[model samples]
Target: MVMKNTESSPDLIDLIFKYIEEEFPEVQDRISELKPTIRKEFSGIETYIRQRSMTDRENQIREVMSLFNGRNATEVARRLNISRATVYRCIKTSAR
Candidate 1:
């Protein structure tokens, strides 16, 4: 549960097992038995979080703004190889 910005998604899965072992030694065996399911759930959550993180959105805006000349979100999107909608969204977000 002590997540760090430097830790990748897979690292969270390993951290969970370590936490369980440290905090609930008696249940370690039971948790190990459910490792596969736990990892699957963690992976899904990681994907969800990565997609929704504000840091990621900010990065997108930074990239878009770097290439923006005030009127070329489409060109910026093409240069960045991202969706036009994504560029537009970043523009809207940065405006706030």
Candidate 2:
């Protein structure tokens, strides 16, 4: 059995498989050879994206700060079209 991204929630994996099934129907039979190679590429990409997400958070903070004349959580939430709690959690978690 090949390992998949541990952090990929089940729904995401399902969606990915759905996409693959649609885009590359040939993978269904030769999954063993395909999964490992794809998994490695995906893992590298996931790492890069995680690193980039941190940079994006800083940019998000800057944009939010500019929009609200400072980092006003509520305004940031409104601008982002997300809940206030989500905005708070994103800012707090991204701090780490």
Best by lDDT: 1
Candidate 1 local lDDT, 1-96, one digit each (tens)? 895776455576677688888998998878767888877765556343454578777887898988888889789988999999988888888898
Give the runs in model 1 whose Cα sits over 4 Å from its true position. 1-52
Candidate 2 regions exceeding 4 Å error are 1-19, 26-29, 32-71
Steric collisions counted per model: 0, 0
RMSD of each candidate relative to the true structure: 11.9, 7.9
Clashes of 2: 0
How much is the lDDT of residue 93 in candidate 1? 80
How much is the lDDT of residue 89 in candidate 2?
65
- Residue by residue across 1-96, what tens digits does model 2's lDDT show? 987776755644456666787899888776556666766666645332264576776777656545554357787788787677867666665557
| Local error of candidate 1 at residue 86 (angstroms) | 0.9
The TM-score, computed over Cα atoms with residue i paired to residue i, of candidate 1 is 0.48
